[model samples]
Target: MDSFDSGGVRIAYIDVPAVGGSGDPVLLIHGFASNHAVNWVNTLWVRTLSQAGYRTVALDNRGHGESEKLYDPEAYGSEDMAGDAVGLLDHLGIGRADVMGYSMGGRIAAHIALDHPTRVRSALIGGLGMHLVEGRGLPAGIAEALEAPAGTPAPNPTAAAFRTFAEQTRSDLRALAACMRGSRQTLSRAEIAQIVVPVLVSVGTLDTVAGDGPGLAALMPNARALDLAGRDHSTAVGAKQHRDGVLAFLAARP
Candidate 1:
């Protein structure tokens, strides 16, 4: 993995070239409590894209993975995180590229498409949907779960899941707590509508975390949704259907 400085924070990332040669670059953003390896590499997204002839660049959001962690809640806003992603493209001298993100990463990708339209050729939003506009983000209890004393049982199912996942990933509890609290900002309908770049909103049919995929996609002029049949939030990212949909979407995109 390589590293770069983004707005004073050191972000860790892996830049893999397409199998044959230079190919269209694609920036990958992982979800909350997940790093580039867990969400992308372990899921075979890097290999899939690379073999499909797309350059893949995946980053660890500030508080997650090998990147420097900040305890300040103000330091983890989606916009700030989005800046880190764009900075990577600038660092690589990429003028524009397709952006793909899941869950929290999906929100960050949307911010990139909205705030830096010129830098995004397309946007693939997975594991997130209408919630990006309607909901605040992960439940507040998730932050508390991350901050709970060691050995304390999580208060609820969602919290327990997050707590366990964070622990499994060996994340910085304090940094993840702040990130959960700070990065919950949701985009407005008008803001979603402003994103003109071609967008694919993919979500599992059984996912309760992400709202309605088609409903969210309908807000944009050039967006559509792909339903991952019978998949849930946790299983959706790595589903073969997801891989196929994304590959097809990427192939068909302008």
Candidate 2:
């Protein structure tokens, strides 16, 4: 992975060209507590896109993966992380590209599509849905779980899942805790409605954490939803259904 300075934070990223030749760029943002490799590479998303002739670029948000970690909660806002993503595109001289993000990264991608509309050709939001507008994101206790002592039990299943994932990824728990504390900003209904670019909102039908997929797509003018039947948040990211849906969406994007 390569590194770049984004608003004074060091962000790590990998830029992979399409197998045949240069192609339309696709910027990928991974979910919280997960990095480029775990969320995209290990999931075969990079390969999937590359084989389909789309250049894939993925980045580690400031506090995750090989990026510089920050402990200040204020530094982890979704908009701030969105800026890092835009900066990566600017660094690579890409003025616009297809952007995709999962879960928390979906929130950041939403910010990019909304706040920097000119830089986003299309947006693919995965593992997220109406929660991007209605809810605050994740849940309470996740930050606490990240900060708890190693043997301490989390207060709930969701928190425990996050804690276990952070541990599995060997994340900087304090940095992720601060990220959790600061990055839960949600978009309003009116704001979501203003995203005019082609958009695909996909979520697992069985997911409890992402709100309603069809409900969210209904709020956007040019967005549609894909239900990953029988999948949940944990299983949705790499599911074959998800990949197929995304490929179809990209193929049909204007």
Candidate 3:
């Protein structure tokens, strides 16, 4: 884990170099309530991308991992999050790079491509969609369940992991909810259409959070969709099929 000061906020990230040699840098952004290690590292994403001849850079988005978490709801806006990526690239002297983002990170990537086109060469968005501007369709009981404290000790690590991830996120749940709400109002198909970079829109077949994969793909002018058969949002991130599809897309890029 390396650290860099991006516009006064301390940012944490891991830079994984390609196997053969340095290649096009690919910045990775993880989802909500998860850190870079949890979302990407544990999923073999860095290894997969590096092996495919791409230098992978995964960052702990503010408020999620080792990065500083601002309590102010206003700080969690997509523009602010997108600026962090742009700031990181500027700090590192990277002019432009391909970017891949999942879930909330995917939303940030869209904003980055829309707002900072000169700094983005291409984009791969997963676990999310342009249609999800209003936020993922959360279940009715989810909000209540998330707010309530754990009643008993978890039996297994997987259960414990879920609790821990959830607890850590509760620190700024209101901010998170607000950010999701604001994202929908801030992002639009017209804005997305302005992005000229090549894009790959990927979603799990059972991903309820992102809505229809093809519907989201239709919003982008230069985009294509990749469906991970038989996989849900959580499982798709680590699935071999997902990695293979991403690699194929990256390889075909100019």
RMSD (Å) per prediction: 0.8, 0.8, 4.1
Model 1, 93: alpha-carbon shift in Å? 0.8
* Tens-digit lDDT track of model 3 for 13-93: 888889999889999998877788878988999988888888889898876677875555566778888888888888777
What candidate 2 gets wrong by more than 4 Å, as runs, is none
Q: What is the lDDT, from 0 to 100, of the residue 57 in candidate 3?
A: 90
lDDT: the better of candidates 2 and 3: 2
Model 1 misplaced regions, further than 4 Å: none
Ranked by lDDT from best down, the candidates are 2, 1, 3
TM-score: the better of candidates 1 and 3: 1
Tens digit per residue, CA lDDT, model 1, 122-184: 999999989999984355588888898988887788999999999999999999999988997
Task: State TM-scores per candidate.
Answer: 0.98, 0.98, 0.86
Cα lDDT, model 3, residue 116: 88
What tens-digit string does per-residue lDDT give for candidate 2 at 1-254? Answer: 89999989999999999999999999999999999999999999999999999999999999999999999999999999999999999999999999999999999999999999999999999999989988744668999999999989999889999999999999999999999988878999999999999999989988999999999999999999999999999899999989998999899888
Worst 10 residues of 2 by lDDT: 130-139
